[model samples]
Target: MSRHRRQRGGPTFARAATLLQITKLVEFPAVFLSSIVQANVLPSRQYGQLVVDLSIAFIAATVMSLGVEESLQRALAANPRDRAIWTEALASRAFVGLALTLLAGILLVCDQTSLAIVGCIVVANSIYDLVVAQTASLLRPAVPSIFNIAAVIAASSATLLVRPSSSISCLTITLIFSSLRTAGCVLLSCRLLKPVRLSFRDAVRMPNLADRGWRPLVDLTVYRLTNNILNRQGDLIIAGIVAVDKTSVGTYALAFSLTTAANTVFLTGIGSMTLTRFSATYAESGKFELGKSWQRMTYLTAFLSSWPLAILIAIGPGLSVILFHGKYPGLALYLVLIGVVAWLGRISGGGANIAVLFTLRNEKLVRKVFLMAAAMNVATDFVLMPLIGMYGAIVGTMIGTFFSSRFLNVQIRRRTRSSVEWSPLLLLSCLTAIVTAPVALLHRSFTLSICAVVVSLCLWATFSWRSSICPPEISSRVHDVFGKKSSVGTD
Candidate 1:
């Protein structure tokens, strides 16, 4: 009945879940700092520039990373000793990071904002990857989130004082500094590996050539590439099509920043546990229960996300008006959508993605999937944005994600002889849709808030009744999450 214990899985789940919760706690700081940034520091022009910079940087970092971060995750089984990964991962990252930094500097000098942004993102992200890989090798999830929070707090404090008008430069500088901080923290925390000093011997021990997971690496690479294009391409589009207004850009960036904060919930809680569960589940029962567990997890996410999302969509306008000083006038509407996006991320199947990312040989299809989706996403954005604005980019994103999931699901079926339960998904989707309607349309925050409470109570009661009748096999797991607070499935 432990929260970390699934029907089957290793002891690592406890560490993983704890790490996730710790990471989730960091979201509080991230969100809080972002609000401050939007309210006081980031103007439209500065914010817009940050987006352009991030979009470019993210793409570069992703390319240079070449799925190495994921490779670390996928290769956990083969390299359980966690020896050479740090050295090799760091060296590889260093090479990519330097190249990208130089490239960004050149682009900046040449006045190519987008290209410079991309290069900056790449270098910054590479530092982040190296830190993350080392942390994971230490097999300590909490370390990563802890590093993340510390780094953010430090960066925000430094940047807030300077409060530079140029967000792009400030952001890039903070990122580099933060990455260094994270690396130091992660290295220090790795008591298990007893990390030898970074030297010739460390370099020799950290092998760059891991042969086991190239196939899965390809899959992961492609998936991330396409997903990023879908999610991060907006800055480019905004810069190109819009009037290059910084305030407009800043408002949107602030909204997206908030969204990123919101999405951390899924990353820490769902993604962390789901990945751990997959490791355990595959080891325990092949793929049979994976599908069922996936369905159940998806349902739980649907319910959990719905209430907060409803509140956001309902009260968002009022909150924005009061809190933001029209810095981001209608940001609440976008925030609601962002919450939906965050919640939808839960369905991306942590296990399947991990399995595919680790494959050294069978990853060709995954690469193809990424390339095709990226192409299609760009095409959709190109076609849609002129007509529909930012939502057009979202459309492109939806198309790409739908394809990715369908592709992953196909692989899932072939591997495990299991299928997604479309019926329940559809049912919940419909219920969420109906429940979300009043919040979207009803402007009165108090009324909507009251309605939301009533609806949540009703839904919980119904879910509780269903669980009693069916008798959840994983009822014990509920005790761990709720502890003495309360659990839905348990009597």
Candidate 2:
């Protein structure tokens, strides 16, 4: 049954995956440029505060969203023409947004942070998330890309144009940029699905969703919030506990931003597609027979994620020195370590687990795993950050990810009990070590190490083609692209 299903729908799935990858590629340059601007233009102290405020806004927005972005996507993907789902989801989302606004206002009064900027950023970013999901749910993967690309380009240009004197001013520009992107995405989403006449008043109205409908939102939100705390919000904890100055705080934040940019892109692209793909598969197959798909996607994610981190490790030092004018010394090493952590995140079964488990409606397991990891991360950060500083925080994040991945692997095994390949993951892990070992051991000449890593990856790819561990879809695509007639049977 699974074989027949794969034979019939594999090409469509492949195309969806490709379009999703293109979406990430489209967003990457703008996001990277924006990060560069944020890192370079501001004073360290101000940057640190900016990082804190931004993180707060992000977390608050996620909390406010109540996981509606993903929940809406999953629901809408199941019934794309369901206007009621759209109205109800948006209504609940707006209610949460209003509550968040009041909370942001209180925080603004107490902390003297720019509430207006944070508020705008939160609303805009959250709206964008929903609209992207909306578009993707309708199988218009490329439409979100158009809106996102335009917004990113506009934001990047505005960042250059405004030349804000203060961090607050810079943040205001950031908010405006996000708002522009949100506006574009919303407009596009609405235009593409015009039968569902959505309105502003509908956003504030009470959603008449059932308890089962709302449960997934809460579960997803918990996992997402905890995950964000582990990855993005930890910098604030580091700042409060260990940082003596704003520069140090900003340095840690910058290191995170630089190292995890690739991680964000890959996850955003892959994550956006997985739920829809998995749900659609279940709808067709009438069973959760997606172990092979999960394995293939996981391996593909590792392949897509590893090399960028390797290159970043290689070029980060020189780039940091040149870009920041030596403001962040030892940043290259930080980038290398953080990059490895990011690489581990991909191969260690984190992304696949989240997508698969969620699609399976195993939200209980997902929440438990993330909660456990989040707790460990927070504890590790508290214990280590003050003792060892920024490295400690990075270590804390790695440790949490490791725990999460390990738990996820165990859960996948227990649930699916299918023969999913792990050798590719093992090989990729070795490749990661090989790619980063030189920089870790000798601590010099990142360019040479980068060349070595690239050569090794090319050789790995050359050899991987002959191995059964490689995903058949990827191997076939490689052959087709290079004009080779090949039949790599799907395992």
**Reference-based lDDT, each prediction:** 0.52, 0.64
Listed in order, each prediction's TM-score against the native is: 0.73, 0.82
Clashes of 1: 18
Off by over 4 Å in 1: 1-15, 31-56, 78-146, 176-180, 183-186, 189-209, 212-219, 234-249, 272-308, 341-345, 348-362, 429-440, 444-491
Candidate 1, 359-379: lDDT as tens digits: 323466666776787777778
lDDT of 2 by residue, 168-221 (tens): 555545555555665564455445336666566665443423446767667878
Candidate 1, 163: how far from true, in Å? 3.3
